[model samples]
Target chain A: MKKHNYSAGPCILPQEVFEKSAQAILDFNNSGLSILEISHRSKDFVAVMDEARALVLELLNLEGKGYEVLFLGGGASLEFLMVPYNLMKVNGKAAYLDTGTWASGAIKEAKHFGETVVVASSKPENYNHIPKGYTIPSDADYFHCTSNNTIFGTQMKSFPETNIPLVCDMSSDIFSRVLDFSKFDLIYAGAQKNMGPAGATLVVVKTEILGKTGRTIPSMLDYQQHVSKESMYNTPPVFPVYASLLTLQWLKKLGGIAAIEKINDAKANLLYSEIDRNPLFKGTVAKEDRSNMNVTFLLNDEAHQEKFDSMWKAAGISGLAGHRSVGGYRASMYNALPLESVQVLVDVMQELEKNS
Target chain B: MKKHNYSAGPCILPQEVFEKSAQAILDFNNSGLSILEISHRSKDFVAVMDEARALVLELLNLEGKGYEVLFLGGGASLEFLMVPYNLMKVNGKAAYLDTGTWASGAIKEAKHFGETVVVASSKPENYNHIPKGYTIPSDADYFHCTSNNTIFGTQMKSFPETNIPLVCDMSSDIFSRVLDFSKFDLIYAGAQKNMGPAGATLVVVKTEILGKTGRTIPSMLDYQQHVSKESMYNTPPVFPVYASLLTLQWLKKLGGIAAIEKINDAKANLLYSEIDRNPLFKGTVAKEDRSNMNVTFLLNDEAHQEKFDSMWKAAGISGLAGHRSVGGYRASMYNALPLESVQVLVDVMQELEKNS
Candidate 1:
């Protein structure tokens, strides 16, 4: 009984990924060795690393655009420090758009490097919507933003136009929708959300944006060092990287991101429509800025809480409870979550309204 | 058939770990979810983390000694920078013993913080032996050493007596030998060897030694932050951590570190004895400093290289090729490798001697 898994990240992956990844652990490529035991420098693993890197570029349409992909460990949290270490020059200021907790975390790390300016923040309103109409300073080292806020259930529908090295952390919403990815000079995502599992992070950066920071960066934090070594700067997170490749291959087989985007849109529309029509439920964030990935909403009446909880649990719904900050139900419909699963939740929502 | 895995780090783990890890990916603990899909904050995973951390201290005989365990990402390479950031004070110096490639790498990262003094180095002799009788600066922030050099096949048989904080990088040989666990203030190891898979790193630190550097470390790099949150400061490398827990559990079932040390010693003795007795083979490193974990040796003549290579391959010996820096064969017998595998290798060496 594999329930409808809506875990925000480390969420649902394609069933095929689960099967193949398990098989690899037992015996990788029939090499008579577990994937965990093989050397990172082995020809078999080198091919996995190379193919995964190339697939990232091919899917993002950045293959010939001077973009290089790196699969790193430490999740997006480490990227907060690495981004500032590799991009913020000595005594240079960085501009950040404060959307949510993760965005503020990035700002905090950048402040350690130099001046970190918050252009505008929706924090006062509890980050229910993306802050807009903020002016970007051209003198800043780079402009940083997070594409989607997983906890707050708000997302940036449009990115601001900026010339000075546009950077984004797409940890929760990468590959969920189609975007002109080359517009940003740098992009990083923790693979847990929509890509793969929880160990590896995907970093796609334009090499030209690096090496100008002027600060003496440590080798592990320096993007150029990782680029030169082809992400083998240290022994990579082997199992995570291999599993991520399996998920990426599954996406490609289903016609890449463009095809999955349609399925995702359908899932989002079905659930959002039910939230809007049902009398017992109410949506949580601003309607226009609602995340297509994480749909946060609440039961309108407190008396219905226990009943609604039991109903969803009985209907095989898991991870529907919202984050502590947002106090409600959040259905995280990532790329691997099927439309049928979303409909099951909608039916449960409709049943609650009728019984009330 | 499972081959005799001799690859360096990211080397062999218990076969039980492999079977259980593969099963967890499909359905973890009958939770109707894959281990790869479960939330790290969930009760099931929190139990896993708590048990794993407790097991590390118990195995090291550091329990109830104010030692805290952390499973982090970025490998031991990231620790190169973090060790300096968390310990070195403003304008303070640190002393390091350069034993091999990894030891030198740690020294390189420490130079960026402040003055870094290399008390001794065996680089001139190509790291064939450990540097001895180095004086530690009492005024230095800390003293660092690597317990085993994986690439050069040399290890420190005895540690230095120092008043300063003693730190060790035990990436290649952790959990494979019994040590005076209370002697060192801090120990770190990448989990690729003798533990589990790659991605997660194990850090055991005496908490009292922290926060004296007076440096405002980044939240991710701060050991205090991880300790406070109980290693859940951020999303951890979930799969790697889980697999490591499995390996640790396997070790405890086989009577813990004291038991594994005897088996590890036996394997090393059987293989090294053959290397010394075989006319066609010679050990590469100094006799006394040879590592019990990684056994490096070479063919006495280039003519025998082809026949010996074929013999080992036919016997299902994998990853016997030495590192490029040490041009010979390296037989890494970690905790999981059996004495039977070493016997198989010794038999092949004797057969090669007979043919020659």
Candidate 2:
């Protein structure tokens, strides 16, 4: 069966990326050495690291614009702590808009370093929508927000333009759309969602914004050290970086982020239209705030739950189950997901309605 | 030509483990989802996590011995900081043994968290031997040491029997030999060498020894949180963990660490014998403290450098060039390296002698 993978993270990558990565694991660049075993400092693997860092900037249209990209280990969860450790200073305050679980996580870590103010939060309504009308305090060291919420399936349609240094965690929706690259002072994403695998976290930081945090930062968590060493201050997560490079290559070959956004929009629209039209289902988040990457929905009639799950399983669907926090189905339409897969899901929804 | 990989870390894995891990990356356990895409919370990957953790304890004979195993990201470099963060309290002191680069790295990080005492060091002799007769301070929070110095090619043949907690960075020599697991309160090994790949760090900590630091450890660095969550405090490096599980399975199938130790010893003996006998080469580390995993040597005469380098390259040897700091050669013989490969390297040395 051809499986339609909708996993929230460690999520689907382009099949070509998968094939190429697998081949590299056997014989990377005809070196007769597995990518799994080659030294990160080796010329071939170093080229991979260089290409991955370069492509991240190129795809974001931020090339040579003073934005440095670092491929680091520990995923976005660690980034939650590292961001504040490196940027938030002693006695300084940072503003955070808590849209979902990840945002709250970031806020929690930021508080450990200094003062953090939650300007607004959607947690009051179970995080079903992106919080709006939040005012960034001029005194805040930086303003942080999660661009997309994977668990609740809400995405910010518009970002706040502020003089305060803007930081965004784009873990779930990075590379799935085109956005202004120059506005944010810093952006980070775990590659598992739209980029590549789970080990490497992609960090794009404006070099000027770093080293201002008066507090001493641990070497491993310091952005300045990582950027200065080009993400090789220590042995990096070599295989994940290589896999991300291959995925970035695939994204570039497919015309970069701009081209993927159109397909992503179509996939989101196709599945959302069925949810609105079918009597058996309803969309989870507010219509305008719906995530183009993760489409979440719930069955209107609880009795049809088992039947609907079986139907999707029979259709070779995988990872459609929603998070425990939000009990429903979530179809994660990352950049690599085909529109035909969304059509198949829409057909399953229509079939469920007809059966009822 | 088949490559003989001796690159220290992101180093060699068993061929069977490689095949299985590569296949899983395509379609993990017939779930029709790539291992790269599967959720860490999924039953299949959870099993991989559980089995890998269990095997660590099993191989070390520490199962049900009040120890918990965690698979984390950022490799040993991150652990260099984390070890002190979670264990060293503010105003407290920790004792350290400065063996080589990684130990010195660990010492540098530990100093940021609290006062760190270098109880002993081998740096005076260019780290050519593991320091002996060092007494650890009982007043210290913990005594830290690197079990194997990868760059200097020195291994500790004995461990301190002290009342103070002992923490070891066994990045290079883990799973290559049997050790007294109960004597140490904490043991960490980066999975790139003798384990799997270059992403996850394996931490085995005695549960009762945590939470005494009195400082708030970041959740990501806190061992308690990782133990409670079973190493899924966040989306772990899933692919690396899975690959590690496959390697552990391979290790277990080959009669665990004890059996591999014999082979590792044989391979080291075979290579070191040639290094000692060949007039053109001489071992760098002291004979008594020379590592069984990494055998460091230098050309007796600098004139033979190009000839020796080309000879190894022609014999399909990779990663034989030593670390720049050492300026010689390092042949890392991990568990997966066959004795036959060492013999091949030995033959190359003999051929160099004949050519001279």
Give me the TM-scores of chain B across the candidates: 0.99, 0.98
Q: What lDDT does the true structure give each of the candidates? A: 0.94, 0.90
User: Judged by DockQ, which candidate is best?
Assistant: 1
Q: Cα miss at A39, model 2 (Å)?
A: 0.4
State the fnat of model 2: 0.80
Q: Give one digit per residue, the lDDT tens place, for model 2 in A92-197.
A: 8899999999999998888788899999998989999987887899988899999999999999999998998899999999988999978999999998988888
List, residue by residue over B99-162, the lDDT tens digit for candidate 2.
Answer: 9999999999998988999999989899999888988889999999999998989999999888
Task: Note the residue pairs that clash in candidate 2.
Answer: none
How much is the TM-score of the A chain of model 1? 0.99
**Model 1 C-alpha lDDT per residue in residues A282-329, reported as the tens digit of each score:** 888899899999999998898999999999999888999999998989
Name the regions of candidate 1 deviating beyond 4 angstroms. Answer: none
Candidate number of the best lDDT? 1
Residue A290, model 1: lDDT of: 93
